[model samples]
Target chain A: MGMTFTSNVLKDGLSRIQREIDAAFDAQLPVPDDMSASLVEAMRYAAIGGGKRVRPLLVASVAELHNGSREQAVRAGCAIEAIHVYSLIHDDLPCMDDDDLRHGKPTLHKKYDDAIAVLAGDSLHALAFDLLASPEMSNDPAVRAELVHALASASGHKGMAGGQVMDIAAEEAGGDLDLHTITRLQQLKTGALLGAAVEMGAIIGRVPSEGRSHLRNYARDIGLAFQIADDLLDVEGDEEAAGKALRKDDAAGKQTFVTLMGAEQARAQASALADQAIGHLSAYGSEADILRELARFIVERDR
Target chain B: MGMTFTSNVLKDGLSRIQREIDAAFDAQLPVPDDMSASLVEAMRYAAIGGGKRVRPLLVASVAELHNGSREQAVRAGCAIEAIHVYSLIHDDLPCMDDDDLRHGKPTLHKKYDDAIAVLAGDSLHALAFDLLASPEMSNDPAVRAELVHALASASGHKGMAGGQVMDIAAEEAGGDLDLHTITRLQQLKTGALLGAAVEMGAIIGRVPSEGRSHLRNYARDIGLAFQIADDLLDVEGDEEAAGKALRKDDAAGKQTFVTLMGAEQARAQASALADQAIGHLSAYGSEADILRELARFIVERDR
Candidate 1:
């Protein structure tokens, strides 16, 4: 019956992974002088520009709990973040989400040119696969393969792409859509990656298969909750506080949980999902406390 | 000297892989009963549309040549093509390359909205990784890991992105770039993937380290030759023949080999490179005949 919010609940994990990602970006930069300048700029822009390092931190914490070495966990975390950052860069292109604002600043394409943004995103994606398959993860090939599969599934169409397709279709249709359809679309598009983050940590940690199943379930619940909260935020959040536009969902003629089920109901559902997600942590004992806090953080964040 | 143009090189391979990719797409499609009409149309417009299937075919061919089974190679090839297609979609975005043409038709974003283009590209990317890591690649953990590493490196900042960066910067600088710089850029941007294609085949085939080295070298040379020929075509070929605008290099202020060395020299260089690439196949004897033919095909293509 007791839950304490540790201000630095995942600080060591976050900082360590952030440091690793920073080093990777740095090492990858100052590329050969003969290289294209746009590519160099794009890589630097996508990899180094500041953002909340939440995903990387989550990976590290989950890996640690699953008994993976910090070194391995941190590297995997960095790899996942690379994928995340890459997706954002591509998403922000004038063609995709077309938003100028990301994390309260210009998206990569906006800051650079569209070509750089596209190339940068592409490179980040490549970097992700390389890092996972690198010797940094483990000498054990099985562990490495598991991690690769988990990451790939999250990044690709059946997961993220499938979700995106659904969202686009929904938008074009531009009429009343049921909450179920919206949630399903969000789950595939956004939830898949988030869930994969947690699941990948378990895979890398070599957690028992049964325990991995429980952790994935935990991830799934929170991932959905995270999306629902995001949808709610778009409706209720302040633009400055959220670090992006508000009510743009309505502007886009997109249907969200808030639009389909009303804001009050969406809030209730998100809380319920978060609580459900946290409940699954009982299976992990104290090892999963950090994860529970992360679930709460997902819904609580304004930006 | 005896080369007949037969498009059926990977015909069997393409048919098999194409079927799989189509199935994957079908399984992922939102049931028509689930949403409004426009969203489904956008999804279909992006995913169901087609291309020449070059990237995947390369993967399958390379993988089979090295040691892997045709079936396995086909899957890997399809995955690589997905990544390539994803890149093309994003690159053609209005914010990026902004080309109105693709595969002799309107680009994805042109047919659909910018948002759909972005999401589709992203989906394809995620799908590629998923395919690489899927059970289809292998039950063997080490093989899957190898596949992931090969594909990721080709796609990432250090490889393709690095190449793209060099390309954009050189173009923007708008001056005579040395052969070394230009070659490096072209190699990294285009050759890297081609090299990766060959490498993926080697990994799938479980080719010996030495053989892989030789194969990779051959692939790099051929890849560059392919690009050089492409540059030549832009300068000399008809727009209708090329299926896109010609003389884009001059218009974009880009520095191609032709721009640096002039037409005749560039043509001679390409021929020399193609010969060098063919020479690498001496070790494989008849096993590499198709590859040898491909090398010739690279320079011979008018478009």
Candidate 2:
């Protein structure tokens, strides 16, 4: 199958982000000796292995738009991805989601035992903040502090972890959240960090306030649209896709946009949000093609 | 019920530290409406409820020696306690230590669900670096960044979490470890953060390099002594107490100093280290009384 132009650009950007991220994790995570070999391996397995690399793409794309340092943006992306993977590791614990598989492989706990999984995830969380504040990320202490503050806010109780609490509550309460409640939950759980990705790019590039607002609007729309696309993918099998599609949400008894808005309407809403998200980048002109393409590519990818 | 002089001073100092910490936790961890009410409440439950507050006291005492700001020292202490409690929460998880009780109360996971416990622990971890970089902790960006760096190093895979991985490895490997390996593990898992607590106070107080090194040496001694004392308590109970004494380590199938070195030898070692720890404060004379008393108290506390 031939790749479309948008898909090509997205693929190219994602491949670059993956390489940069892999290197960042390698340089950042080293097993001290045999004693910590398993823990480091768990960290490496969870972090450096293959995935979509969407968050890093967003970070790099936005940072590029504002003329930020690519090296710095990649570093920031590594930090963001570290938090994302840590959350996933903990979420997949037997006492939590109990999932045995992630990224098409056995979960860390399945491979290394639960205690190692917990410690690795915990370490990754610490490493994220460490990377954000490190000299490698930014020599400017204020920028480092800002990154720490912002990333912490996005990942803390009021953000992703807090959102997880609500998500679990929603599941236990029979998966019957109204659209508004679900939106708020998703905003906290998923959207906060996505939006922070864009915002951090702006912060690194020293984007002006008005410019940052526009980027944030872009992130907000794309973040929600992305989750909706995910929900749609979950409800309706990806056409010609292998194994990942279908109604796992139903199995998990999750309340998602597709359940609330129907697949057709959810798909339409996602498209409209992508269009509006692209519109938010009007000032960036052709320079924002990657972002615009990314918005469109996110919902359309089969895998 | 007449208090001994050492107890009187320790009690007065602890009372003040407890009050300050409670206030910090209250002001810092607010449940917003209802969404994260459980998570925040759980954080309060694990953190603000009650503990020895020894970490905070160590931070305060060391900072006081260096003439650091009390408000700042207390805030830093709160951050340290948050990490300590988060570690405790995760450590007590069923997949980990499987402890049902901590600080003489039901553990967070036992009291709530595992998900809530994990999220609460994760949130407290975030709150820690957030608090460290916050204006309330320090107006200087360098100090804030230094703090974020130091605490993260102490908490990351190389430090507390790494130590935990080793601890679990030790236990799962039939609790067999040479004294040196176990000592190294304790240094990473427990001593690192404890020493960090002392070093952080020095950082906050802007202690000169020589003085900081001295404080660190003091921290190192006390840190190891504290663990040995804990092992002693585990084996022999509080020197003058009962019911908690003997064979608990044997039952837990864990190798400890008392088990490896014999109870008498362990007790002597702790006392010698405490003496050495106190010697590290020779430069401070009268100002070091509480710190000196704290070294003795750590090994001697009835609880």
Candidate 3:
């Protein structure tokens, strides 16, 4: 791989997606001049002007590889990002992780009251499906339905929320979990949405299920690699650079890849998984360069 | 109206929908014997064997009026009911209503913990969209997409959740709201979902937006009447029969219909609204009898 080219593509792609994601949210969540104004303001505070936009980048890149429209993919990406943002808001509530900071600022619950935070999170949750089911998502009703199904399945009890349940349970168990259990938990917690991002892109491209095996494999590999990288970052990264609390896993005594496998081995594993993820896209040419570079960046970036 | 005949239809319809809604939840939320077991258990606990199933009943009754398939309507009803139930669960959280009892039992957060309660509520919210987007909801993808769209729009910030924000603000405002403002607040908080229930049924029955004026009117009237009746219940009805806290509006110093208008006037207003709601269904004679009786039952019910 050409290091400079990969760096440029990854950096430019990240910046472009960050802009688009913010713009999409700005367009969707206009605060009404009413009692709900603060709620929408909280949603805007949480959604816009922050985050890495990694999920949206994945959705756009995968969609590009499959020749999907940029506009539709961006819309779908916003839907996915809404789910991610809402989860974070709720996770930061006093009853949950009890964090006071997110994205280098006061968390939604801290900025607003707990009730506003809860309702804002919920409003965003509903907004995800609303965006997906809208006519703007796709001209074909089947496509919109498929997108809603993919997202809803990834978000519900059997997926992201369920993973959260396992996470809380694992914490209660004093982090005495095996590697397999931790892997499953992360897959449910973070991997499900990552996988859905890719799957929704395929659906947008009208790619059949059987034809998406390589993409699915690519998503699966990167999902695990992403979690391992996150674990490593939590252990070694700076809070200022990460823009959120670091060392939380260590402080909470939660089982993570770095704890279970050690930093050195975990780093190696993440690299190998990223390599495997790129390998899954071997059939595609330069059109998939962004995705390939994204895989590499997943393990290489500081945050 | 024939008194006995209307009463029988209303009784049978409510019971049937109650059974169907419970059965649908039972079939959907099968707990996995894993770390997430408690999460799913909390979901099942919050979802099944509770509530009046009024939303689902509205969906079924409206769908029946349009001659839509019973099974499909029941499925859509379940989707709406899921949204309703999730809202109730979140509304009962410590940061929100701070209620201990719901449906004559401990609230989910009280029974389990706040984390479980939050995730369970979120899971069910996603499940509502998942169920609507599923093939089982409708043979036509267009219908499925429309159902998701309807439910999502109704439940989001501009609708039910937005209404909740206003409700909270009203409480903070020391119950000084006028009748118009309170009416608008109640419309969004409760009327949106009720209106969506009827609208979704119309969509399932293949009624276009232009042809839905009468049904929409009926829904709007009943929605307000339902809230007014609820206020009456809060003031005068027994907690044992109502299955939850009562007189919360007075306790919190929140403005409600009963506070803005005297009890006698509010009762008369609800009764008049119910009559007008039934009047909107005049075009459909015996076919909409259940709906008509339902309008009557809305103001007349003790709990």
User: How much is the lDDT of residue A227 in candidate 2?
Assistant: 86
A9 Cα displacement, candidate 3 (Å): 1.1
For model 1, the superposed segments whose C-alpha errors exceed 4 Å read A1-3, A6-32, B2-67
Best by DockQ: 3
Model 2 over residues B1-303: C-alpha lDDT tens digits? 122325767778988999999999999988788567889999999998667888899989988987899989998999999999999999888888777777667789989988898889999999998898866667898888888888898999889898888777777675568899879988888899998799788888898657587788888888888888877777656422421224455677888887789988888898899889888888887878888888888777655
lDDT by residue (A1-303, candidate 2, tens digit) is 123425667778888899999999999988677477788889999998666778888888888987889998999999899999999899989888887777667888998888888888999999999898876778888888878887888999989998899888888777557999999999889999998888888878888657578888888898899889888877665533623225667887888898888889998898899889989988877778889888887677665
Model 3 spans with C-alpha error above 4 angstroms: A1-6, B1-6
In candidate 3 chain A, what residue range of length 10 has the lowest lDDT sum?
Answer: A1-10
lDDT of each: 0.73, 0.84, 0.91
Which pairs of residues clash in candidate 3, taking residues 3 or more apart in a chain or in different chains?
none
By lDDT, the best candidate is 3
At residue A209, give the lDDT of candidate 3: 81
Among all windows of ten consecutive residues in candidate 3 chain B, which has the lowest summed lDDT?
B1-10
Q: How much does each candidate deviate from the true structure in C-alpha RMSD?
A: 3.3, 2.7, 1.4
Q: Using DockQ as the measure, what is the rank order of every candidate, best first?
A: 3, 2, 1
B180 in model 3: Cα distance from truth in Å?
Answer: 0.8
CA displacement after TM-score superposition, residue A110 of candidate 3 (Å): 0.4
- Give the range of the ten consecutive residues with the poorest summed lDDT in model 2 chain A: A237-246
Q: Please compute the TM-score of chain B alone for each predicted structure, in the order given.
A: 0.88, 0.93, 0.97
Error of 1 at B269 (Å): 2.0
Docking class for model 3 is high
Give a tens-digit lDDT track for model 1, residues B1-303. Answer: 534434455345456556765565555455455433334455445555365555555666666666678767766776777677777777677766678886577887788777767666766676667777766678887888888887788777667767666766777778868888788878877888888788878878888667577777788888888889989999898887666667888899888989888989988888888889888877776666667767777787766
- Fnat values, candidates in order: 0.80, 0.85, 0.94
